[model samples]
Target: GAGVSQTPSNKVTEKGKYVELRCDPISGHTALYWYRQSLGQGPEFLIYFQGTGAADDSGLPNDRFFAVRPEGSVSTLKIQRTERGDSAVYLCASSKDPSGANVLTFGAGSRLTVL
Candidate 1:
């Protein structure tokens, strides 16, 4: 079975731009989550999707951040009006379900560097 995976691993973007980060979750997993980790800080939950619906998105900072899991598997995180404060490692994780203790298997993450 494949584990969660993310693209770019590193991204350099300027302020006020838009970017899309991709995530590929493990097969057969129905729960996906997105988190952002700043330097020396714990990962902050962004959004979580169960099946095709976003079960939790309150963690999203603002309208500038959005995510979707249209097919109930792969997910993508979109950021708009990027700012230097937004620089962080955006991580994606997947699990069997909440019943599975919500244990998340994480991706290496897409590191965003806003300049």
Candidate 2:
């Protein structure tokens, strides 16, 4: 698809384990973002990347969660010492503009289950 592509659609891990999720944006989309959605809650912003750098990463919960888009196209979200509370649907999105208005396209998401 031309939209964002997220790998490992689903993941199950034990507590304290580490995980890495991948996202591939549509060609030429310069703005990429990562969000985590818990059961019954809205998606929470995790990070925002513009081009090759992260423009807004304040949404990241802590140092244990990090994201990178070294080439402005593909992004990776890394989580360390996973906890049961960390379980959620990790979503990836991309847009043509950096202002983060509308026009955002999202992936199906990588569902993480930390047991």
Candidate 3:
């Protein structure tokens, strides 16, 4: 992909169902991030992965939310026990370096609707 790419541009699920969102970053980006954005609000950081290891995951709301980047180029965000409160757009971003957070290339995001 030329830039960050996210799958399932839109997703609708029952309140208790699970969902997975995938992100394929630029070919050589080393820093990947997962974020959740509510309507009218800025994206909230969920996790940050530097290479194949998670460098910061403190922003994850609970155990139900998890993200991984096994090979450092692609990532997936998994959510279990979905709730209405979890309905939001999941944004993926990638940067060449952790210090380059200010210049991340973000994907269009996957919109999750929990009903």
Which candidate has the highest TM-score of all? 3
**TM-score of model 2 relative to the true fold?**
0.95
> Candidate 2 — which residues are off by over 4 angstroms?
none
Q: Give the lowest summed-lDDT range of ten residues in model 1.
A: 94-103
Q: How far out, in Å, is residue 97 in model 2?
A: 1.2
Displacement of residue 82 (Cα, Å) in model 1 is 0.4
lDDT of 2 by residue, 1-115 (tens): 4778999999999999999999999898888989999999999998888899988999999899988888778999999999999999999999988777758899999999999
RMSD of each: 1.1, 1.0, 1.0
| Alpha carbon lDDT of each predicted model | 0.93, 0.92, 0.94
Clashing pairs in 2: none
- Which 10 consecutive residues of model 2 have the lowest summed lDDT? 95-104
Better of 2 and 3 by lDDT: 3
lDDT of 3 by residue, 49-98 (tens): 99999999999999999998999889999999999999999999999976
For candidate 3, give the lDDT of residue 68. Answer: 88
Model 1 alpha-carbon miss at residue 108, Å? 0.5
Give lDDT tens digits, candidate 1, residues 1-115: 4788899799999999999999999998999999999999999999999998998899999999999999998899999999999999999999987554688999999999999
- The CA root-mean-square deviation of candidate 3, after full C-alpha superposition on the true structure, stands at 1.0
